[model samples]
Each structure stands twice: as C-alpha cells, then as structure tokens.
Target: MSENRIYLASKSPRRKELLQQVGIAYEVLLLRDAPPRGPDVTEIVLPGEKPQAYVARVTQEKADMAWKVIQLRGLPQRPVLAADTTVVLGEQILGKPANRDAAIAMLSQLAGQTHQVLTSIAVRSALGLHTVTQCSDVSFAAMNQAEIAAYCDTSEPYDKAGGYGIQGAAARYIANIRGSYSGIMGLPIFETCQLLEAAGVRTTTDRSL
Candidate 1:
C-alpha cells in the first residue's frame, strides 16, 4: 500500500467506496469547502467536441481546479483525484438531466438502445498528474413511459450521467455491457488502479505492476 496519504477531491460516495474496495486509504475533500471557482462552472462540452474529448477535458479541468483549491487553502497537499462520466448516443452526448422533463426525454431515447458510457479519471500527485479514460458499451431494453417515470421518481437517475446508473435501480434496464462494468458505475477499477499506481498511489497489489 502507498505510504503516502491520499486526498480525494470528490464528493461521490461511489468513488470513495470503489477506492476502499481496492484497499486504497484516502481522505475526502469536498469542493464546497475548497473555495468557489468564481461560480458554478458549467462544464462546457465545447463546439463540436466528441464524447472522448469532453470526458477527458472535464476530468483534467476538475483535477486542475481542485489542485488550485488545494494551493489556495494550503490544504495538506496529497494526491488529488477527480473524475467525469458521460453517456454518448451516436454523436450526441447525453449528460445529466437538467430537469424532470429532460430526464423523461433522455430515458425515452435510451429505451431499447445501446449507448457508450465514457468515464475519465485524473490523478494529481507529487510525481505528476495522469488521466485515464474508460469506455463501456451498455444496452438497454425497451421501456415504457411508466417505467421511466417510476425510475425517475427515485434518486437513481437525477445525478448520474446518461440519466442512469448501472449499480442503481436502473440496473434492471441494462441488458448487456461490453466494457468495464465499474466504469459505467462511474470508475473503472482496472484503469483507475493503473492511473493511481502510475501517479505513485501505492496499493497492496504492488506486484501487479
């Protein structure tokens, strides 16, 4: 395991849980207390930005923003980890639903369709900063309006990108996936572990490298 302490720059419990699953000890650093970045920076997808580009850009932006926060606050400068997830349908990329109506529309479009889930994680440490992108192909069964409405009523889809979560109640809608299941859930263990290790975030499985 890494002898160095880790500072997680995210509020996602799933990421925390995933880190713990891999035996990586870390401390949480919420952005709320990390000072504001002027205002809520609407993560821009940019004009004609592809899903891969958007995902990687956001992940780096988040890590870079958090690094600035650490420097400004003089917080214990440990490795800062950040990530972003997106759902891509053909050339159109679907991010989090802006409202209930948007949620319904997104779910309807995703009904009985296969979409690409792209997750990017960036790790910043004393060694340097490294970013990794993981892609997953997820297929969903055709769903009715009632199904979409019922799922939307819960807390599952609102905060998740692509309007759904593979590990949440929305799991029932997924028929098959062709990539990292954990990536769809938000973080891919294989890629995340690799990035962390490269950034000098030590783990028990040192020999795996």
Candidate 2:
C-alpha cells in the first residue's frame, strides 16, 4: 500500500479512533457538505429494499461519493473508505432522532427490547470497491425517563444510530451484545479490517510511512 493511499471517507471520531487503534494511517474524505449522517431520509428505498439492501445501497453510495470527491479534486488516486450503521427493531429501521421528543420516544420504545445493529463498511480502490456488513443483536434493559433524559442530555446518543451508544453512558442500558461490539459503536473492527486488507490498505508501519 502506498503511504498516502488510505482515505477514511468519514469524520466520525469513533471510526477514526478504530482505524488508528489498528495503526492504519488515513486521511479524511468528507462525503458531502453536510456530514454523512444516518439513512438518507430523502432516498426512497425501492419497493423490495430490505434492511440489508437499504444499508448496502447507502454504504456503497457513500463510498462512491468519496471516490467522486477524490476524482473531482484531482488528487493522486488512492483507496477511500466509507461506512453506514443502522439500528433496527424487527421491521422498523431507526435512524437518529429528529428532535428531543422523538429521541425520548425512540428510547422509550427500545427499553426492555432487543434490536439489531447493522454496520456496513465500504472501500473504493482502483481495482473496485469492497464492502462488508456486520450485524449484532443488542438487548437493552428497561429504562425510565430519568435514565433516558440523563443519557440524552449529553451528546452521546444524538449523533449515534438507534439514539444510543454502546461505548458511552448508554452502555448502562445495554443488557448484553451478541455480535461485534465495535459494529454497534459504528464500525466493525474485524469487517473493516477485511475491507481494508482486501483493498490493500495495510496497517503495518512499514507501509504507513
């Protein structure tokens, strides 16, 4: 891998920290003027767009957008990475809350229920784009208004999918997790490594420098 060929198409601190934790040196590739948040509210998933399909579509779109940015900027070609995460309760897909009231309602609905966290990561290289989607089932213990309000008052849940973060104070509400913990946090470490490795995004210091 070239020293400057790795680009993270996101500004997510969690995603950045995860990549850095594994010693992967990368530059940020912002997808759009506004940060790439949850599901594109305006994107109408086709009639048969299942959760997995919807997520894959968005993930690929984000990765492709980053690639377009790099191309438009006329920077030396390199690999760009992008990802999307969604929280689902049965057939209902939950995105970031629209407001405090919506957040409270989502939290209320999630209390004492189990939901699936799906995180998909994509990488675009000269060869082609690679992607991986990981799913983890998380169970949340019952939460009261006090607990929800306390967690919501902070910035932890607002930006995260499902309106809660597994690594933050919201951890208190999670009874247990059955998949990649990092996935719930936004990026699946194992799957992300797979995508990077496949795209030749090496983590060895030998390559980073």
Candidate 3:
C-alpha cells in the first residue's frame, strides 16, 4: 500500500464519504470471506457497559477484526481504521432501530431533547493502535407525531444510530448542535486525521519536512 492509502474496515457509506471529503485515500478491506470469529465482533453491548465505553470497545474490536483480516488475506500491512457511533440519552444507549416502529419511538424520545452522539475511532498499524472519541450534543426541536411519521416514512433512519441521520432530512429537526458536525454524521474528520497521522499514514494535505 502506498503511504497515502490506508484500509477502512467499515462498510458505512457515510464514513467513506467523510474520508473522501478529507482527501484521505483508503481501500475497503474485504471481510465477507473472512472467517467468522465467534460473535459478530462489534455489536453486543455488555450489561452495564457505559455508552462511551461501549463505543470505544466496539471501535477497537472493529480495528482488531480488520487487522486479523489483513493477516489472514496477506494483504499489505497498511493502517486499518474503524469507527463506531452511538446515540445516548443519559445512560441509555440507542443503537440503530430494528424497524420503523422502533425508529419512530427513538425519534419521538429525542424530540425537544438534548442527546449525546459519541463516535469512537480506532486505527491499527505498524506504529501501534490509537483511538479517540468525539462526543457532540444535539438538540432537537419539538416534533409532532405527523412530522415524525413523515420522516420515518422516508426510510432514512433505519440504518443510522439514534434512528436519524444528521446530514439527511433530520437536519431540519435539529435546533442546535455543540461539537463536531462531522462526528454526528459518523466520523469526525479532524480526529480521524489526527489518528491517521499518528499511525504514520499520509494524507493528501500532509507536507513532508
């Protein structure tokens, strides 16, 4: 792999778009053929696991899984990056809704309330493992049943944490946000680049001294 290219272990289109926005070259690592190692490797939330800790743990697991895939496939040893994002209201962690009704319920609860969006990123490379988390507070305006139903009908919330995508139709529902907008979208570009640089991956904007 070239110095400018890394391996992205996630299958999220949002994460890929974020990386492209920052001009970071990356190749998607194939994990379909990779052996199933025990559990899903990144989805279970242990009992009493703090939201922050859960996201961090999941991100690390993703990176570790990607590393194993690299070794198993004999792929070039480039930095492998993975991330996990979660929505939290107090101690409750809201992951991707399982269905339309669940998405509606999650969105209704978030209406006119302030919640935390935590995104944790982990990168594994020859330099070692580096991880960082970005927490952003998002406040939503009061939403009515009609609005919620209409939004959910768009079918955009099913695959996203907290049952809504900040960069999608849900943007109109946001009254305020305090923190990285990109983080709310899935990946925080600033923190991602920081970890990438620390892992010795070069970006297009990096200048060699």
Indicate which candidate wins on lDDT: 3
Cα-based TM-score, every candidate: 0.90, 0.89, 0.94
The superposed Cα distance between candidate 3 and the true structure at residue 106, in angstroms, equals 0.4
Ordering by TM-score = 3, 1, 2
Cα lDDT listed for each candidate: 0.83, 0.82, 0.90
* Least well predicted 10-residue stretch by lDDT in candidate 1: 33-42
State the lDDT of candidate 2 residue by residue for 1-209, as single tens digits.
45645888778999999888878778886655444332332344678678888888888988887777777777678888888889899978888887787788889989999999989889899989898899999999999899888777887768878888888888887898999998988889888877877887664557436
Best model per TM-score = 3
Task: Please identify which of the two predictions, 1 or 3, would achieve the higher lDDT against the true structure.
Answer: 3
| Clash number for candidate 3 | 0
Give the C-alpha lDDT of model 3: 0.90
Error of 1 at 92 (Å): 1.1
Better of 1 and 3 by TM-score: 3
